[model samples]
Target chain A: MSIQDEFSFINQIKPTTVHHEKTLITGIGDDAAVYIPSPNQSQIICTDTLVEEIHFTSQTMSPFQIGYKALAVNISDIAAMGGNPLYYLVSIAIPSSWSEQDLIEIYAGMSELANSHRVDLIGGDTVSSKDSLMITVTVIGETEEGRQLLRSHAKSGDVVFVTGTIGDSSAGLELLLSKGRHGTFNSNEDFLIKRHQYPNPQVKIGRFLSKLKRVSLNDISDGLASESNELAEASQVTITLNANLIPLSKELVSCDSEGAIEKALFGGEDFELVGTMSMDEWESIQQDGRLQNLIKIGTVSSGKPEVLLQLENELITLEKKGYNHFKK
Target chain B: MSIQDEFSFINQIKPTTVHHEKTLITGIGDDAAVYIPSPNQSQIICTDTLVEEIHFTSQTMSPFQIGYKALAVNISDIAAMGGNPLYYLVSIAIPSSWSEQDLIEIYAGMSELANSHRVDLIGGDTVSSKDSLMITVTVIGETEEGRQLLRSHAKSGDVVFVTGTIGDSSAGLELLLSKGRHGTFNSNEDFLIKRHQYPNPQVKIGRFLSKLKRVSLNDISDGLASESNELAEASQVTITLNANLIPLSKELVSCDSEGAIEKALFGGEDFELVGTMSMDEWESIQQDGRLQNLIKIGTVSSGKPEVLLQLENELITLEKKGYNHFKK
Candidate 1:
């Protein structure tokens, strides 16, 4: 469709999450979304940016996939905080050599994920570049009264828990890079490939945990150890992890123990929920089966973060863990 | 101040404005800006991107200025539609070349303007770029009920008007490129320099125009001729410009008439609002002393967009008379 048609079509994905803030009159489809004010809820805001070579390899993923992932990652952040995904603004820069089909695919991919997440694409910026492609997605989400979860909320003695499986994404990335072709892997491993390339966000789980049921929470995009470190840093509490308990993929079992453990601990883009719950609440959820692999790996502590690897009789500091975005 | 201190401290300015629609929940602050939604208002959305070596040269403007302009241009789109300036989301990709100090200054510039406009910065994406630097800003604004203007609203027999002057930015750019470090120009003329370096988005004027006072509206960023043509195409109406009525800079007056007219008609980045207004409303606004230089420049007609010259005495179709980001 034409550019005008695309915009008109986008207009239909207006948000349904009713707003209590009196200031915001129009959210997505205007020159600027209007906001009056609501004394009831204090707004929380954040922003991020991605570049062509830095965030993704245009060699591996399509522009559309890149576009979708850009927003998906941001949405994961809001979900980690137990917030409802409301709307998002996007900004893109493409090189002159790129085709119109490339742009169409990019927006189409973003629109696809955005529609599924029910987050409206409100507005953004597009400009031509002499360099590589760049995409940025900014999301707005809301938390109900007294339900917002933060990294700082993990009190000492709170049980550390994670939802769903981890290391699948990192493993998938290794497979994609090493194998090059998807067909070379076991077709059952197709699921792993998808996890790394197209991570499905757990918004519903986030919402569930936001009910003050969890003392703290974080999305596992930057691997478990990295996020755990973040929780510890923000909460100013020490965390000790039972490295033996951290979940790994069946594929990881075939791999070397050291490799499997490393991936589970530090390979990024897991998109799983790493959270903290009071000892009682953690027990309740484990019995509920609503969360498949929800396991208690350790506890909040007054001392520094430590990884107790029973097999090796080792205790490693949080800094010894793998790579993080801000880390050198 | 240290980079970290500047980054945190820049978030303090929060100016407030009275005019707004009903859909904005929270502007600025938090993880992302919130928008409410008013079904009566048709949301208009647009996005643009800027990259290093493509949009600006660091030699001409500081990184802070670049950051501020990146946001200001996006907001200008909202202004063009006559909408209220609300909060915006930002996405930035930086290369290793930049120091932490550089990032702080860049953000400081953006925060400075956002505070003045009462626009909150909600959320964005940041990633390492392997190549060039990029900054993208997405602004959301609102228009009142029954007042949202569109580029497709012009009708035959309507008078065309433009807010503020045009062509100053192109002139400023010319001076900047020359590296005339010691010379000074008019304070009013300096407006051109700032206009080129930091074009102002007319938020209040846009809010006023989107209130149905005008039949059609667009911002003059890609030159007047291009915008005129866009309105004509969108509205299915013809636009005719009176050669004498176009705004000219003092720098332009010193140049040959042909060169002056070239910049006046086709030079981009003026960031002025161009619109079609009914005869009566046009007269009233003209009589108001506050909007005096807001001049009548043309008229809508039944044919295609045509440029008229007193000497030629005939209509000439203006073809390829403006800047195209792709072509540039």
Candidate 2:
């Protein structure tokens, strides 16, 4: 866009509400956004990128969904660190094929999620791309001093738990990508598609986990097997996941059972929190009404850093088989 | 690249030194980076993006220069705000055509600049693109409490000054783009090309100016005319520029005088600081040995927001005629 058009578009989408008004010295319009930090808190930061054709396509997602997912993924990274997301910056490269209206809709989708979480839109960059549209969001968050969770804190005998269901997004992606080939969409297919398009970050659960002692957490963006391996390697422990105990959404389970299991293990983009905590802490979470969906899926043991899956009659090592952009 | 390859690349380029070690709680390894903020300081955040073909071509720049310039522009934004850059995140989309070695060279360029500024490379995202490569960097900086320069702070009776020579980058770009049409590269041509490829951010001068009262500052990334108009509009004042006083590098003046003046007025990507301050403060800057290159360029007056040029023979209204990505 022309510089004038770019500025006008920025003004049009400028945030109306700032969650931490007292701390925010300045927002958009300046060369850089300025803000103060609470003395009692530590800062958390993470960034994620989404590229058209590589991450998603018009056939798979609308502009709104694409924008929402872009910010959602970054927020999930913050959530994994057990931080409360406060502000975010978006840098987008717009292809000439896209219109200003489409960009506005994308911002709308992001604003909806940002508003819900009271996260402020602080600063960003807008540029023109040649062939594909791309967005990269960096989220700034905070946590109480020394309270942020880490992937390296899991201990032997800690119980591993996952929030909500796994593999629904992968199944949803499958349904969306093969809609015409599959006859017609059913209610289950619709549910899975929504799961794929509108995956939510488990911020509340992450914060709760952070309040507990010695918990290791990671966001499940790279499939169960891959995330489990990361947690294991980071913590220097062996993680054993029970195949039967893994939570699968009803929509995902309604599909072929073997395929569902495979997807649950190796499919990605779930955006759920998977963590390990002491058994005592797990008991406390069990009694909390707000954490009813938290499911016990595995255990951390002191050994060589690796991930293993326990099937009905057999046990096997799980490979890091999640999506890889340049595997070929 | 595959996830493993991406991780290995991250490890290869991970920062070896962190300037503010006490404030950094974590860097580059977990779900997100964590840091502590000093109670006496405010944070500055900015992001910038560079796209292949649109922002740079292989013919005009090497991968290393592209990477260095990407981070330099974002640092310039922080410098314009008079803040000390502390940390940064890079989100890059690499095309299949680029080699891993090329990516490493890009990182090397960025690391050289980053290390000089003592900025930590905390986190980033690396993904695959189908065609063009892109890089977006988000830099976080800090400044003393309530001590930030802004575009809206200029007042009537203020004298405007710009540090260093202007339009050298523009002239350099012209030389590089028309090298074959002209004769082989001369020393002056080489010097101009270097100016285009290696623009410096005026952090020290910006900090010096920030110590003064009520200074309005901007970086001349989008040429003098466009940036002057922005300052005038933002500060709600009319600015009159003395055309002869605008500093031009000797190398730039060696070329066509009229063309050099035009490029100085309308060319972009000359990352020099421009600001307005009281006459007393300007005198103080003049007395400082480190600020000898600062030049008085214009005066701010209370009037309708507009920018004007004071030519030797006739005065005329200056147009905002800078580069716009989508003007066509």
Candidate 3:
């Protein structure tokens, strides 16, 4: 089917299930989508784009995974801002060779995620590309009045924390490239692969944390080291991370890779939240079973803006930061 | 400069000038841009993307023009909804070969337009593309309660009107491909070239028209014939257009190209607003000197959804509808 036919099919199926918002004036099938804002709700918006070869290669990624991860990253951004995911606009460019079934499955992956998060697939544009498949998802979310989080809000004496484990995705990519040629994998390998393919955005945890006052937040997208430096620079405070205190899954350690800490520090696509809050707020969150594993990894200090890594009583300044797209 | 460094530069410059809404709690420099929507206002959002080879070539389009046109098309979508353009999120994928100055100029073009419209550049992600340059812009706007215009609202007797001339962009493309070999051009050619490069979205006019009741609207990005048919199909009405009544720029007509009318009907990238309203409403609009040239070229009727082109003596069914991205 052609692009127009595919759009018509998508319109008819309504694959995405959106939680009804009374303020939404219109949904789809127009030049733009319209909705009314709820009283005292602040709107938060962010956009992320995924390219074919640069982001993920077809050798290690499927069409469905691509769709899922594209939306997942944008949702992660919203979560970092302490906003509830509401609506998303997706723009996709497909090559001529892609089959209609591939496109449909891609949308299905996105719709499944959207349904779980209660985000409405409001409006987007589809076009033909000459080379690769690219998807850009723009998410619009809202938070209660004065409840939004920012990277610039971290203060001295706040304890830095992170949700879940890190560096699994980059390790999974490494495994796919080096050992996948043998075409066999064990159970732990499979788990790592799935972790890389699908990341769970900490929306629930982010919303829970937003209620607490005086917190700074950011998602670990470009790796812990890069995001930590960003948070420190934005807040004009120094952040020191205990490299050993950083949480690592047994699966990651058992994988037996050298430079495991470095990978966790500099790799990209973790999709986990890392932020700083006072000890009192952190202790209160620790009481809840849902956040029992939220690990305290460092402390915010009053100093020149920088990120320092501590290992075995020695402190080292970071030399190589996280992934930079334009750096050769 | 690296992508991160470039983003830092953008943050320092704050290229986008946003019309401050009292509800906006935060703008840029964070995980997301936050704004509180005013009470009784309906939010409108739309997104559009432009690719390297599919949209234009380096020979015909400067980096600044590419950036300008990329945002212009999205702004046009908002205008079609009769919503005021507010904040925009831009996602751009750049190849490694591009210079930092090229990237800066691109943002300058978008900034120039954003400042004029008072839309804030909130937050976006930049990635490295393997091959080409691709940019996506998403614009968020709002209208007063119940003032949003839609294509599905065209009534059976509503008259169809178009702002500005049609087919100039496509005509400019033909000129660029056929006769622009030596890079020398006449005054008329220059006018057509500029029309193709810089399209002025009718944002002010759309905001004005949104207050009127029972109006249908769409921007003529694909062409008059294509948008008219879209409006008709959406509203389930028959639209008939007078071929001679469709306005064409004198520069386009004097270019002496064959099939000028057909180009006006089937060519793409016009970026003009074509919609339907009552005759009374049209007359009232005509009384305003700003809207004196809003040409009425067609009428809506209750019939099988289709678009017909009327010449001097014959009414011909439109066979070549518009540019479909996936059509062979």
The prediction achieving the highest TM-score against the true structure is 2
Q: Candidate 2, TM-score vs. the true structure?
A: 0.97
DockQ of 3: 0.69
- Recovered fraction of real interface contacts per model: 0.46, 0.79, 0.80
Better of 2 and 3 by lDDT: 2
List, residue by residue over A202-281, the lDDT tens digit for candidate 2: 89988888888888999999899988888998999999999999998888888756698888888989999888999887
- Residue A299 displacement (Å), model 3: 1.0
Q: Tens digit of lDDT per residue, candidate 1, span B18-126? A: 2343445444332334454444443444556678877777755677888788788877887877776666666666677877777767777877778778766655555
**Comparing 1 and 2 on DockQ, the stronger one:** 2
DockQ top scorer = 2
Q: Which stretches in model 2 have alpha-carbon errors above 4 Å?
A: A1-4, A180-184, A287-292, B1-4, B180-184, B287-292
- Full-model lDDT for every candidate: 0.67, 0.87, 0.83
What ordering of candidates by DockQ runs from best to worst?
Answer: 2, 3, 1
Best by lDDT: 2
Per-residue accuracy of model 1 over A147-206 as CA lDDT, tens digit each:
667776788779888877678777777776776533477754666767777877778888
